[model samples]
Target: MNSSLSLEDFIASEKASLSEAMQMIDKNTHGIVFISDEKGVLIASLTDGDVRRYLLSGGAMNCRAIEAANNAPKSALSQKEAKKIFHKRDYVVIPIVDKKGRIVDIYTGDPKEQKLFRESLNVPVVINAGGKGSRLYPLTKVLPKPLIPVGDLPILELIMKSYLYNGCADFHIIVNYKKDLIKTYFRENEAHYNIRWYDENEPLGTGGGLSLLKKEIHETFFFANCDVLLDSNYAEILKFHKEHHNVITMVCAYKNFNIPYGVVEIGKDGVIQEMKEKPLISYLTNTGIYVVEPEVLDDIQDNISIGFPDIIEYERSKGRRTAVYPVRGNDWMDMGQFPELEKMRVRLSSE
Candidate 1:
């Protein structure tokens, strides 16, 4: 059983808002929280997956947490029973409830036994590594952006390993800027990665390069930029894409910004309708990662500079499905610029 967190940290009131439960889940880093009634009786359990599903179904964030929770969550009477349940099922956490139906403790199994629980997805990965990386100017002058080291490993290697962990081995890399250096680096490295290289004669935008591989990839695959790292479950993302029957699913991160001053809204007659101080706003930002279907590549024009978002819009115009998968803000990291490079290095090193 995990003891690092207090019982209160694992429990939320039934009347708490969904957003508050989400914040608690994020703080615990366990992706779950237990909901209790006013008398401290267990009512339901909520996870990040549940919240995501609720949001995708058009549920409001201000709704009660119980509205999006599982009312019949599994519970155990003892830690030993919880351990057995953990081994028998795929559950990560179990609540220990007393005869009165109040939660006494939580069981998370042994720390060492907490491995990544994901079904192996042996899919192909396409990496866009041809960018000039003008933001990292001086470093890009000496070494290709893909070759820049985050810790001991290059950024490209880190990106590959993330997919490889989810059982993806086949890689198709499109290179143009400093292509020779990138190719040579992989050639010299001892780690055997199943990578195929493609070259572009002229500078092609992110989506345009996909035209080069028009008929090569016949199945669904993951496409991502070289400089961004998403600390998320790749298998879950793939599952969402396939289950929703979407042609393209863009991975987006929720970023929250706080205003420094009071904000006021005016009415038609110059009357102040509403005023608030230092409001926090949340929005989703694209993380340069996507789950794409093979046929989408056929829509790209050869040698045309078009962004991936433009391709999504074009597909949407044709009545094809395109959607977004939301992830937490800290789960997405970008090393495209100098300051973010150092931050990425620190984040990866601590891991």
Candidate 2:
């Protein structure tokens, strides 16, 4: 459990034989300690799993453990870069190298490195999962859209995980269509979340659902759609919203478009000024995520289907500040249809 395994000692030298590599692993529980050469150059690594996999792959115990290293990711600019790429995959382990691509160190991405310190937190979160998901068609016939599975978990689970990863846990799920299925699923599972449900009773537009929570909330909380997933720093977004003193903060993802056919730029009448083929364009789009203050909730009429945006428009009329946080397209996904579901499944499985 040594989180500080140094790569300088575990890596074998260029001339060192396989026998020396085995001794190093034996001393450090087989690659838990970082491996590096005498000149402090990183070369290759052996992990406990590597040993197991090697043996399972028909490798004998006598075989040099160094041979198990699958071309260690070489670090060029810095050691951290190599660590990130190598650890991004299964059995996170890393090899650090210099500008010359010679291994400078070895690292194991300990799970502890991913831990986040809990700060003084008090904000609540509202998740809008009430949609009937008519876009999903036949699939929605039997299950609520939020309850629909994406990979081994539901789309909603991934959404919550993204939020939870940033240390925001309080939640309120808005439900209406197939409320039983939503309730039943949560009841049967052992999820340690402080959650409450607000039923719309009838179909409500996205903005209208937040209107139902006026009575239960009074502070700032993030409002998110269950159908979309966004990987972002919630705490940073909340801080930006507060520092900017904005009433509403929208999280947007930048999407790029490239037209395959020639595109023309014309002026006034029908004169073509110029033409560009496969031009790349970018746009900031609604990511279905938001940071809202409690004051906006008060504008909703009791039991009304008015959603959060309705309040945004109302407040905007009074010159309220509305802002947006832009993220990369890779950080967001919308799975409201069969085609998108297929894409999501493939993407998740690949990850």
Candidate 3:
């Protein structure tokens, strides 16, 4: 199909939320979303990279789309000139605006028209599926947590496929509690899986499993918990991790919560300084996904039970570079609990 987008599908209001802007970008089939004023005048442009940087800098996703947009965007004054600029700059898409700054049309180019060179990344994935899922209770009694079905497939399979889509197929799974069940399921499944099993003799915390991978993985790899699912683009996560030269990159989600009651701040003289009623609070929280460099594996002590966070802290103490990539809250789901698991099932079924 051709790649031209309708005005409504390509343009978003400047006051629109970040989610709305993302939707417009997705609908347009192009990477850029144009922000327009009430009169349909183009004010700014937003790209996926712009949004990523804004979120990384702690920008709230609930804020106006313009807050993360490029106010000074390149555009052509005429359609004839736009084609020239588009070809010269090799832009994916460029907006053509009139004298009044309104986007009259867009110059669209098919990526198929150009020569593209893409290479697959060879990165191993490590999943910490060892913990006894006490929270999942009765269900955990019969089957391992990784074997639990999300929809048609087990949660662990879904996690593997998520990485598989990004050219990462090699997997190292840490198994302890109900390890036999997990191994059995993978063995019997029709689909061939490339997996190396690491059996922990005893309970090892999240980061402890990496001790087994010290000799196996010699490149950048992905580490994740078996219970969480993130909808963000995995390729971009890897790109960001490598660009920053980080020893470890944690994937975090920005969550928003509204206060249930009014809050007041008072000065020392008992004078009310400010008051807010049910204000929205936003925070970046860990989503249990990571991009780790191979050298960091040396930091893990042998046969020690330590959580991933402790290892991150230890690396920081030694002046290691640790960064975070923030994703929208709705893009992340935790299937550890019954409530969340049900939520994920419903959401996936709809998709």
Candidate 4:
């Protein structure tokens, strides 16, 4: 276990802002953070999932991180003890504290040591990489959006590996704009991906391209946008879909945005019923990811431009079961827009 990281690197004050805590968590990249009081005594612990659940449960993002921190965090008094707990629990990271409950060091399990126990999921993943990526503009003008580098790998590779890590091997990629560049890149690299490419003769909107896969895929499969990545267990989502008997499971993110000013709710007579300060709002936004049973493919009209959302609605209208699987806020990262792309670049580069 490496103890090179100073306690300051992983410790945050109880009063620290949620945003600050998130940055620390991101910098740590260990999925866990320690929270302490002014006296430098450990008070609580926060994981990326905890912060996300807080926000999803109406906790303000700008509020203190302590609001979401776990007061009864699992910890050990010494490094030796911590190691035992870590191995027994298979925890990714553990914090060590002294007699006074002040964090002295941190212990992290080596990922390399866990390869033999890795769980592999045998599911087909479909990536919609056909969009022009107009949001990225000049950058997309030269390199296709999916090929644009994030850290060392392109966005598409990251999306693929997220699934591959969970045992997914086969892939079906739908491409249209700058299709040749994508095919050529994959051809030259000859990466480990078992890729099958479907070129859209014309820009068939998101769901329309699925018509090409009606014959190709028969089982439940993952469908995702090339520009988004979810830092989550793919197998859990699949299990949820199967257990619930959903025809389609839409993966969503719990997003929180604050209203800049007070807003009033009007009554029937146009009189104000209630008013709120710069209140924070939260909602489950679709992350453009789905686990779909092949039967849903029948709703997609052949070669017609229909967005995925429309397809979902069409399925619902036909009495198909659809459900939403919500992931933490930090778990979902979108690189489709300019600002988000830049943020994702910095975050990925750090990793």
Winning candidate number (lDDT): 1
lDDT of each: 0.88, 0.69, 0.85, 0.85
- For model 2, the run of ten residues with the poorest summed lDDT: 26-35
TM-score per candidate, in order? 0.89, 0.68, 0.80, 0.78
> Who is ahead in TM-score, 1 or 4?
1
Candidate 2 Cα outliers beyond 4 Å, as residue runs: 1-112, 116-122
The TM-score of candidate 2 is 0.68
Candidate 3 segments exceeding 4 Å error:
1-34, 55-64, 72-119
Error of 3 at 234 (Å): 1.8
Across 233-284, the per-residue lDDT of candidate 1 in tens digits comes to 8888998999999999999876656689999999999999999898655567
RMSD, candidate 2, Å: 14.6
Which lDDT tens digits does candidate 2 get at residues 35-148? 455665556555444543454366654455456664463343455665566556533445556665556555555556554543434578789988889999888988889988
The predictions' CA RMSDs to the true structure, in order, are: 2.5, 14.6, 4.8, 4.4
> Candidate 1's error at 267, in angstroms?
2.1
Worst 10-residue lDDT window for candidate 4 reads: 109-118
Q: Could you arrange the candidates by lDDT from highest to lowest?
A: 1, 3, 4, 2
Residue 297's lDDT in candidate 3:
93
